[model samples]
Target chain A: MYDFSADIADCAQAVEAALDAYLVPDRLSGPGPAAIRIIDAMRHGSLKGGKRLRPLLVRQAAAVFGVAPGQALTAGLAVEAIHCYSLIHDDLPAMDDDDLRRGRPTVHKAFDEATAILAGDALLTHAFALLADPACHPDPSVRIGLVTELALGSGVGGMVGGQMRDIEGEAGGFSGNDIAIMQAMKTGALIRASVRMGALLGKADPEALAALTLYAEAAGRAFQLADDILDVVATPEAMGKATGKDAAMGKQTRVSQLGLDGARAELDATIAEAIAALTPFGPPAEALRATARFFATRQS
Target chain B: MYDFSADIADCAQAVEAALDAYLVPDRLSGPGPAAIRIIDAMRHGSLKGGKRLRPLLVRQAAAVFGVAPGQALTAGLAVEAIHCYSLIHDDLPAMDDDDLRRGRPTVHKAFDEATAILAGDALLTHAFALLADPACHPDPSVRIGLVTELALGSGVGGMVGGQMRDIEGEAGGFSGNDIAIMQAMKTGALIRASVRMGALLGKADPEALAALTLYAEAAGRAFQLADDILDVVATPEAMGKATGKDAAMGKQTRVSQLGLDGARAELDATIAEAIAALTPFGPPAEALRATARFFATRQS
Candidate 1:
């Protein structure tokens, strides 16, 4: 079994450092006060603590392709910024209507709703700006690839699309297949982009991209299953956010569809599939496989 | 002196043709139903009839720089998409809460609030995708420049930022300087970008770019002042949308600050300044100058 306690901790620390440096106050200079506030709000959402799972996936995939860990920091930062923006918007009054996020007041709850909306908009727009910065990457092709990956992943066909389905699926019962589709998009898309971007940054070959994608998909599913189980079984204090809200809202979840035991079984199978997909990637993939196991079984 | 009816008719036709091509059954092929609905809603908002002023500015600026008109269409489409997205979001219940737009129900009123929000998100994301397409411009540098222009013009530093300030200024009194800053971003930024992108597409010199920026700034201010004048003088039927809503909402306006006659004088001076700025670009800039004149005095 992979030991995530140490490795994932290191990855999380690296992500935090990179994000702080990336979103430094100097980077947002020259814009007017309105623009500055938007940037500040984006930083507020992005710099807040999370597990940094997406950025970690990016770093590990880059490692598998022989990229130095430090060199992957910029790509990892860009992906995290996009993820952060999505979360800010998803928690808005018109969307998910959540007041707390990651154990603290959400951006909208901290700022006004309009400011939060604009902050999310600015963050999404700025993610592309960062990726397109030629100074950030030596290869133009890589920058283009990164932009395309991010656009497709967070755009209508990816995360946002998945979110729309999740909202739509709330009113009606969704099939297991439908639930899978939503999970793949609402959560899986960004996770998948993390690995794909890491491979592209490291100049990985076709085989490596395919393998990493499979690994990310399995890991993503396991993570969602774990979230579903936690939503039902964990307390708000333990989970750091509201629990059982999804079920109360009549949203379809693994626990609702598969029951607690079946959901736990599915999580185990997904963790195994994730690990199996990483077999061809060898030792560099060890950390990622361990991360998946940790995601599947974590209490919070 | 300028006849805008003919130009508006032609631009509307162009927009419709392009949108019809975009919305054909084939373009709707996607994984999820929610994605399809969001895209449909986006197309519905974006393709609807309007003056197409931004695209025309792009085309006219390109002509001034001697580039083929065809080169302006895609950029024109991209700008319109951004503009429409902004309008949709601005008209949301949390924002402007308008029921009618351009003689039709607003996107949020036509669809549900959630779909309207998602549609705006989809259009904004897709605008970059359209600009970045290889087919849109073979030169990577050109594509990058367009992306930068569009992103900056739409972000907090540009239109969205301006909208935020507009809201704030209305709720809380602003100084003249604050009003100018908001106008520069809210209206002037995209107008400046429309001309700048046109010049870039035409590969115009730095001198020409500078001239176009000046012209666009003056014209954009003139346009907004004319809008202020119209809101007081024109009826709802004549305006094709709700008028006088600004005053009702206690929003700041040129007329409010400078009086009606003073605002009219400012509009005239702004139009003259726009015309004078174009003198450096010679006769080819006449159409652009004429467009500005039309904006100042047009009934709609």
Candidate 2:
């Protein structure tokens, strides 16, 4: 097995630096002075933390198809922006209402609720602008394609819609299928999009893209299962977030349905499926294969 | 003076229909069963609503360069989606805390606050997806251009940034120029983008686009001034929203700084400036001229 830990750390560092450059308050010195406050809030929410797992997937998947690193990094940043914005909103008082994210005060806790909301909104808006900019891709077609993919992954039928379902499920009555669908939309959609977008950047042929799609779907499921497992077994100190939250909130999850041993078995199988789907690209997919294994076994 | 009232109503109807078609819960029948709740919330917040002013501007502006009505309407609805999402988020308890909008319960009031937030997020995402879609235009460049324009107008330097300023102003230290810049961002950015999107659809040249920019800025100022004046004078019934909010919140506005008489005078001058900027395109700009006049004198 290839070691991908160093590769993950390097990608995370690159994403952090790029996010820093993008979230600066330079706009405050211009006509939009109010922008500095939200920019500050955005930086607080996005900078210096997180696994950058989605961006690393983008870089690794694009590498398999031989896409330029710069182009993949730009698209990855856009995906990260969406991911960061979703976390900010999810942690708001009206949503998950968590006080800590990445082991620090959440955006609303650090600033104010109003600033947090605006910061999330700004980051979401910024993602589209970043994708639409010529710097994202020299060809307008690619830029528009990226925008479409992102919006589909994040919009009504995807992440936000899944969030609505999750909130509704708090009152109980969610089945195993409901849990799967909700998890897919809430977390899996963006993860799938991260890989698909990388393949897009590479302009992979239809069969190659289809194989990547299969790989991403399995990866997305395995990632969510890991999160569910972490929610049950990890300590708050290790997770940087409260653990046992699913039980505390009485939220329905795969672990709740399948039992601990069964869920672990499923996760191992999911990881194998993810790695198997990447077999088409052989050595080019070695990093993707390592990343899939990493998803199921990582503590946080 | 040319009468655009009938044209305005007709365009508004077209936009309403388009919004209805786009926001249906058909996705509920497919893989995303959770999508219906947000879709319903989106419909509740958007359908049979306000004057559809932004979409109206897009249609009229696109009409100036002989663009197809269908293309212009598509672009206009994208702008309106941004407008709708901004309103939904702005009415959150953490923000303006408005319980009523357009004389009905706000999304947060009608649905839960969580649903309202997701609905707003969904709407914002939907707008970009609509623009990036192939149905938006035959030319990918045109679609990408609309995305760039909409993002710039709605992102941090524009509408959402202005919202932060307005929230900060509730503590009351805004100078007159501060009010102008903030209003330009909060309300004017989307307005400017509305017309510019229309021009983009028509492939307007640099000089003509410049003229439209001038017209839009003046029109934007005039529209906000009229709104400020209306807040002072209109009844709750007439406005379909609570009147006297600016004063009650102690928020600064043009009317707060300049006496009502002064604000009205400025509005008249702004309207005139907007009309004068249209001199470059004689009869082609008659509807835009009427829209400027309508913005200053509208009761609601």
Candidate 3:
């Protein structure tokens, strides 16, 4: 069986390395002082530490399909960039209103709210730029597919839709099923895209694509369920950002709907289902299967 | 001479028709009431009344390059979507804080701030989705090129960069050159992209592309100068939205830097240069040339 924990760690490192190279001072050349500040703000938000799990999925799926990891780097970077932009915007004064992110001051707190907003906007647009860069991938079909995947995952039909439901649910009321739908769109879309994109780049067979989709969906749910449990159990320092904010906002969550223990049970079921879905791929998907387990049980 | 005024008007109408079709209520189908609300909010913000000038350029440029006008429709719609997204975000409380746009309530005023933000985010992402859709264009290279153009025009190196400069300039202290740079990025990038994207779609020769770029740059400057003039000379009713917001905010507009008459003279010169840049393209570019004149003189 492939060591999924080690594979994910390697994938994360690869994503971080590419991001570091892309956001290096030299890459932002030819702009005035204000532009430079905006670029700096973008780098500050994007380059800071994160798990890089989404990009890792992209890379790993590529590996399973026998494509070079480098082949998926640009798409991986683009996905992470979108993820970073979402985090920045979500932490804005009018959104989640968080002061911290990944153990550092959130973009709005580090810079001003206007700068943070602009920075987020810049990063979001830049993700497409990276994907479209001729130097990254010569095949236009691949580029187009990657772009569509990322956009749909991040847009109203996906993450934004999920966030809208989240906030609206807070204002109204929601059942467990409603919470699941919200989580699926908000977090599951990107997770599914990560695997799908990686498979696309590797040109994985139809069977593998279907299995990966199922794996990602279940893993995504497990990740969110774990998050709900963490919010209740993890301390501020341990969590690296504000915890328990979901409950404070009177928002619906797996924990809120199912209770902490119930949420944990759900997480276990999700992880098992995620792994089971990958059984069609046999030992080659062991890494993915392990990653699902890890997601369900991560301390942070 | 090609009658650019009539041609551009037709192109604009064609693009609007396609956009209207694409945004029909059926396209937003999915689970969750909140998701539907978000989708509706995005469609409302993006599909509301506007001149459709940016999308028209994409169509016109495509025509200039000899591509079928039908081939440019999706690309045109994509650009307009991006334009609408920017407007929605720019009107948010933390940004321009405007209550009105195009004589109607701004997205935030019509919806909540959070919903408006998500709508903008969704539209921006959806623009790319449209560009990348295989059904829209069979050529992946064309899609990739379009994505690149749109991204650069909208991101830090273009519109977002200009916005940052505008915000920073308002905090006080900037030279005339700084103001020019800001305007070029904020308004000029997308305008230039409109022309360039059209040329790209038409498969214009490199020389034609260069000429179109120059034309777009000049026209963009003239367009901004005209806006400055209108802000000073037009009333709220004449301008559609607030007329004097730029001056009130101490923005470094052409009218603020030069007297109103001086700004008018500059606009005239820029428009003349824009028209001159199109001379090499012969009668084929008459529509673009006329559009330049329209941009210079438009009151709103």
Instruction: For residues A142-230, write the lDDT of model 1, one tens digit per residue.
Output: 77677777777777777888887787787566875988888888888888888888889988888878888899889888988999999
Cα shift from native, residue B82, model 1 (Å): 1.6
Q: Report the lDDT of model 3 for residue B248.
A: 81
lDDT of 1 at B102: 84
lDDT of 3 by residue, A1-300 (tens): 466667777777888778878764355322222387788789889885788888888877777767777887888899999999999999988888899999999998988988888888888888898888865567778778788878877876678889988888777888658888889988888888888888888777788888888888898888888888999899989988989887787777878877988888888998999989887776666667777888977899
DockQ of each: 0.41, 0.59, 0.55
Ranking by lDDT: 2, 3, 1
All candidates' TM-scores?
A: 0.92, 0.97, 0.95
Q: Among all windows of ten consecutive residues in candidate 3 chain A, which has the lowest summed lDDT?
A: A25-34
- Tens digit per residue, CA lDDT, model 1, B74-175: 788888888888888888887888888888888888887778877787677666666776755677677777777777777777787788778777777888
Give the candidates in order of DockQ, highest first. 2, 3, 1
Give the winner by DockQ: 2
**C-alpha RMSD of each candidate structure in angstroms:** 2.8, 1.7, 2.2
lDDT of 2: 0.87
Candidate 2 chain B: 10-residue stretch with minimal lDDT: B25-34
Which candidate leads in lDDT?
2
